[model samples]
Target: MAITSAGIGSGLDINSLVTQLVAAEAQAPTARLDRRQSDLQLRLSAYGQLKSSLSSLSSSLGNLKNFSTFRSYTATSSDSDVFTASSSGKVSKASYDVNVTALAKNHQLSTDPTLAGAQFTDVTDTLSTGTLTFKFGTTTYDSGTDVYTGFVQNPERAAATVTITDSSLEGVRNAINEADIGVTASLIFDGTNYRLSVSSDDTGADNSLEITVADDDGFTNDGSGLSLLSFNGTDNDLLQNEAGVNAGLTLNGIAITSSSNTVASAIDGVSLNLKTLGSASLNVDTDKTKVKTAITAFVASYNAFIGAVNQLTAYNPDTNTAGELNGDGVTRSITSNIQRLLSNPVGVLGSDFTILAEAGITTNPADGRLVINDTTLDKQLNDNFDKFITLFSAYGETTDIYTNFVSSTDDTTVGNYAVNITTLASRGDLVGSAAANLTITGGSNDVITLDIDGVSASVTLSAGTYTAAELVTELKTKINDNTDFSNAGISVDVTESAGVLSLVSRSYGSSSLVDITGGNGKTDLVGAAATSTAGVDVAGTIGGIAATGKGQLLTGTGVTSGLIVEITGATLGDRGSIDFKRGYAEQLGNYVDSLLASDGFFESSTSSLKGRLEDIADERTALADRLNLIETRLRSQFGALDALIAQLQNTSSFLQQQLSALPQIGGSNSR
Candidate 1:
């Protein structure tokens, strides 16, 4: 058997040819295996992609399951009962009376007039009697004794606002009022010019205005004869007037006050439908419409779950192709479990209304849509609304079924459904717990009660003097010492003006109460009348001398003029103590603290769930990175196989060419 090369020689060399073909055929199995491996790799790659997507989706849904919104409603007879009681057929409504009360205190203004004795005498002065001069704030004006009959016509004199009556007495009174002087004057009209008298606008000696008369050719001056009137007692202290501010109203036993004139500003329990006379109350109603809405939501959620399941199972009737998850054990398990959840009994209020079917909801297996029997539903709502609510709400014993479904940690439980598309799209997460507390304290002779917006507490002191300064100091100290006080939201401060003392709370949202007791106790030194027996008096005198006064002595004074000493324990009147309003500030403080803790939304649970979602997102990012690495390796392997196939084809072509060129070497070439 001779061998020749011409594409490995094709004709008549039976044994040799059979050997070569047999060898080629033997290599075919390896190539076939490689092809099979490649095909499998492609399928596996697709499967891997689908699985990754599903897993990612499942993780996302898991995060959504933790969402506060999704899990906000828990199955229970309470929610269900209220809903059922208010619902009629498809609609459910309920009405509740709510009342809000204002915790603010009333403020009043008053006047106190008490002064020592002071004397004044009336002096008769006529234009012919004398020339008078008035001085005010570094400005001075002079009036001649010539009876200045036509002075009103003089532009230069007019600049001084001078006025004169026909009689000298009346002229003086007119002059006082017109001169813009800080004094009052009147004339006792006599046959002659008149007797003029003047009074200081202020009550005490410090406020007394002086008048001087100068003798002139046309006037007679009574220098020593002039005297002003006398007064005994202190000036009046003006109290604040809070009247005509606004009237507060009570709604349904709730006290509501508003700066606004409308009734809507008063209550929150009911929405006020404003009318011409008053308002109409609108309450939540449980009617057929509402019931239908709730049912619809449930159905939509269920359908979404079914759709997700179908997608995973690759149930594509259009293409007649099975899905990536076709025949998957996990998919089958999920579908079966979900069906169980829909038909399972929810133990609510010990009623037979355990499943949706019992509540007048029927499921159609053909299309998987839940249909509601309106008449039956209405009967249930009217007769046993509470039972219906319990069935839907109660998870274990009287809670919602949905709650039980998502809350089930047991993977094998009937309600233990897998993470689904809805949960992923909704971004649900679980909530966590965190809280804080606040406290406030008042000072001696001080009564401090804080009502935070609506929350109130009181701090009372025994009878004593609660000076504005001391109260301010104590408030600051307490706020600094207690973190909860700041967290709860009260701010404190002090204010002083003229001779008055005031304790102020910087925040105004909440109210607090402070009371002072035993604040009245005085040590002996100055007369017992001088000092406050209770809280420290910042303005009281010691030993008959001004307590705040220093660095001076009454040398020329009588025996009472020794070095001034503070009456250590002199008692001021019972009313001498200071009182502060603090409750409002405390309330405000607490509110601020709550706001900070609850992320300003007032829902701590929701805030906690959001935090969990953030963590899940981080996990998904890490998984994606790992999947990318796997894909890169698969791409590299496929590239190598393609290059090897190209090389094998080229070698076969070269061998064939060589065989053709070496033709007929062993067979009948001589012809």
Candidate 2:
């Protein structure tokens, strides 16, 4: 008979034996793989914690790495009803007396009351179709004669034109409003007639409106039809409801005028918002609250980072158990570098505060956390606040006031470097060879095309007869108001000397270019023959080594590789030297950046740990395959033993049967 199961024929527990043998074969290797996997997982987790804590610490260094963070100032006004003030950057701590003399107003114009017959009877009344061009200028109106004595165009404001298509009174108003040309129009009904009221959106003396109508009825300015709305800086067709004027004020007994109610140029770092006509006392002071808060936050962040590291690398002597990163070389190196940076002195020039210790910041030896001495910090803030800022931020100073330190790269070396200038920056100019024509006629000599600083634009001058000064103002206004020039921030200044007109670019350096390309009015405005000249960049040397120049920016070479400075003064030759220094916060921030980069220590370490874990999984799979083979072989051997035992029993049973039969026969015969 064939043995169906391992111990069926032999009556032995072969299945249990095979199971125990297979488990014994797999136990030791599987346990080893599991232990290795668990350790690698713990290491990966520890690295994640370290990376997270370092990121937090880097974030805390933002305000401490820049000098501008400590340049905050507070401004206050004694009387809020009159004015309110705010300050920024570095401002002197002082008090000033302010007196408001007059408030600014917007210019408003309406249809003349005397022209009652020209008024619209209803909102839907038909208006003459024509182009209405609005020009911005400063108008000196004489009320007694109802005539404008002088008009000067504002170069900063561009002229806007509105075309009337709907022709209805309401349509005209809507069309003007939709233009969005810094002007608003409204229809007002007063008892008998409806009149259109137009107002300037800005409040300034030079922001006045002079509306000129190109009537389709062949009457340009006859005080009838579309012409009734024409002012032209001299017509009485439009009534002046309000005059545009500047806001006048006295700051510390000195008179000041501003186009808007908010005045910023009167004070160095303070902006005064005028509310009413009154006096108020203005006070400016340094604000130290933010600095103290930043310091406290830095301390807290530093301590938290230290605590995370301690937990990640902890060891229990009694249990004989060590933390995941207990003896990790990378962790040790990171902490050591941080400690070294914190203990090093910042080489700040012209200041006694060269380290964090001078500002009452020190490291705790026991836990490697930062500790602050409040009394010492308070004294530093009171006495040398600026110096304290330089100690913890990237700072630079120049010996000459004209040479200003702009920026530097990480490759730039610290310490002083001498600055020597070979040439000063200048702007491009075009001068006229002969006297210019003062009359500009439409469709003849009114348009001109120019290329200024690589930007091209076409300008159309207004048709009129003007004096030399008026022509200068007109040229400047037309050229500066061109769409391309205004958008690109390119401008030119026009001046007249003995009937000759000259144009100059407002920019500096070799790229500053002003060229008269082509136009109908080019010859008339700039004369028959004109001279064009291009600008030149500023040249210089730093620390006796040749440097590079771009406009007013002078970049150093050699030891000062990436150092950049702006030269504003014209005085060439020995200008002075710039002293550059990096503080603790900046240094630490750079180090952290390197460690957290894409190919940084954190990424590499984590990747290696994951790779090891995968290898452990592969090894466990191989061990399982071996155990399966061992189980298969043990079962086969036990099955053969069972079969052999069964066969032997069968043979013995047969022999006993035969022997019994023979013994019985012999006994019977003897009897």
The candidate maximizing TM-score is: 2
State the lDDT of candidate 2 residue by residue for 1-671, as single tens digits: 85387788788899999999898888888888988999999999999999998888888888887666678778899999999999875477888999999888888888765775466789897768898888777878765667877767675665678988877778888989999998899999887788889989988888888888888988876767777778775455887788888899998999999878889888888999999999999988766767777777777887888888888888999998888899988898999898888887888433667778888988888988889999999888878877756677766778998998777778778877889999998999989888878998999999888989999888898877877877887788888878899889899998889989889999988989888888999999887778889888889898788889988989888888888899998799999888888887789888987898889899888999999998998898888888888998998888898888888888888998888667565576766
Sequence-dependent TM-score of model 1: 0.31
lDDT (CA) for every model shown? 0.34, 0.84
TM-score of every model versus the real structure:
0.31, 0.90
C-alpha positional error of residue 506 in candidate 2 after TM-score superposition, expressed in Å? 3.5
Clashing pairs in 2: none
Model 2 regions lying over 4 Å from their true place:
1-3, 12-15, 72-74, 86-94, 118-121, 142-149, 220-223, 285-287, 318-321, 348-350, 438-447, 457-489, 645-671
